[model samples]
Target: MNEIVRIDNLSFRYMQGLDNALEKVNLGFEKGAVIGITGPAGAGKSTLLSCINGVIPHYMNGDLQGHVLVNNQEVANLTFGQLAPIVGTVFQDVDFQTVSITVEEEVAFGPENIAIDPAEIENRIIHALESTHITTLRRRAISTLSGGQKQRVAIAAVLSTLPDLLLLDEPTSELDPIGTQEVFEAIFELNKTLGMTVIIVSQKVENLIDCDRIIVLSDGKVAFDGQPRKVFMRSQRLAEVGIAIPEVTAFIIALHKKLGQPISTERLPLSIGEAQTTLENILRQYGVLS
Candidate 1:
């Protein structure tokens, strides 16, 4: 997979800050991968997202150091107008992004601003609504939608621009369990079927466990970057940094600590089904279960 994003020795300090919000952060994201960024509050997760979309130095007042490259183009050098088509961002607050009264208008807003051909704009809106599973809601008013539906519309709005990389900040922060699942299902489907690279900034560990990669940030730096299975294993360190481990992994860790079962690290269980299967196999081996 080609590298879609690259952050090299990146650091930034806001106008009122004494220290950098992001400190010497070095990382790269692969194309067509769903990557999760999570950490405690003040971990610079949002700052990292801003850099990818060329907002750090261009739109926001900040002291920036090092570089951020999207699709091999340096962020600092790209104008917001130039970057808009390359990177699409959905902020944490869905309400803040809601501009149009109707879902169809909302989804078409971005593409229209870019002066895309009228025929192409129509196609983009249709594809975006379908991709985010919001086709039925297109004729409805945005204010009448549920929290999850609003989020889906926000994502669809960004998707209409046909950006190569999508960056979301706490998309499900205000959603219920079912609502969260619906939004994530749409996101993962896009990544899997459409080959769109997605980077989501969230605090929900369970929601991120199945991503192709999970990056844990601390004190404005990357403390862990790898597959979800490996990152979840550092329960102690993650807890110290104020990042909670996924419940399933936490339960398995406790079992290993208490029983000395020597659980294999090859494929640590991240979900209930995986945990159940692993536990049953272990019990069977010990003659405790058939």
Candidate 2:
């Protein structure tokens, strides 16, 4: 896989006297990957994203060590304006990010600032709105939209920039279940259809379960980096770090423990459909089902 982002021996502190927020972190993310970053509060999850998007040294005051490279260009070498072209970041608060009164202007903000051609900007806005399923809300006032609609509008605004890397920080933290699903679906479609490299920093483990890869941060260090099943296998360690395994995977793991029959790691299920199939297969093996 082509490497889209790389962090090498990364460490950072907010001020000279402060303790490191991130400590000796090393990671390489492949292009077009759907990556979930989860950890407890103050675990350096947001700090990591800041590093990726050039917010660490550029906009925020920080003492830094090591390098953050996006598309092989070191983040420190790029100005905030320079980094804006390659990375689009949607912060946790949708309300705070919205400045334009109407959805159309909001979505077009980034592209317009970058001086994209008028025709191209319109095309980008339309494509972004359609991609996020908010075309009908284009003329609506930003304040009139619901949580899900606002989140989608924020994503659409980021999408208008047409960035190669999309970083969202706890996008659904304030959303209801339906809104969460809506935001996630838009993100998944962007990954699947546009092949955009997406890194989402979320506390919601259930939402992270289906990601292509999950990175667990603990005390500013990577505690786990692997498939969802492998990550769940370290449930005890995750809990120690204040991270929870998804409920479905937890239940399946419990069953395997009680049966004294180890379940194949490859067959571990993260979703209901997969769990159902795995359970049915197990029943057949035990002659509980014909």
What's the TM for model 2?
0.94
Model 2, stretches more than 4 Å misplaced?
none
lDDT string for model 1 (1-290, tens) is 58999989998999999899999999999999999999988999999998898778887998899989999989989899988887899987789778899999999999998889989999998988886777999899998998888988998899888778999999878677876787788788777877989999998889897799999999999999999988888888899999888788888878777787766666689999988987887788889998
Candidate 1, which segments miss by more than 4 Å at Cα? none
Candidate 2 lDDT score at position 33: 93
User: Which numbered prediction scores highest in lDDT against the true structure?
Assistant: 2
Give the Å error, residue 39, model 2.
Answer: 0.5
For model 1, name the residue pairs that clash. Answer: none
Name the lDDT value of residue 14 in candidate 2: 92
90 in model 1: Cα distance from truth in Å? 0.7
Ten-residue stretch with the least lDDT total in model 1: 258-267
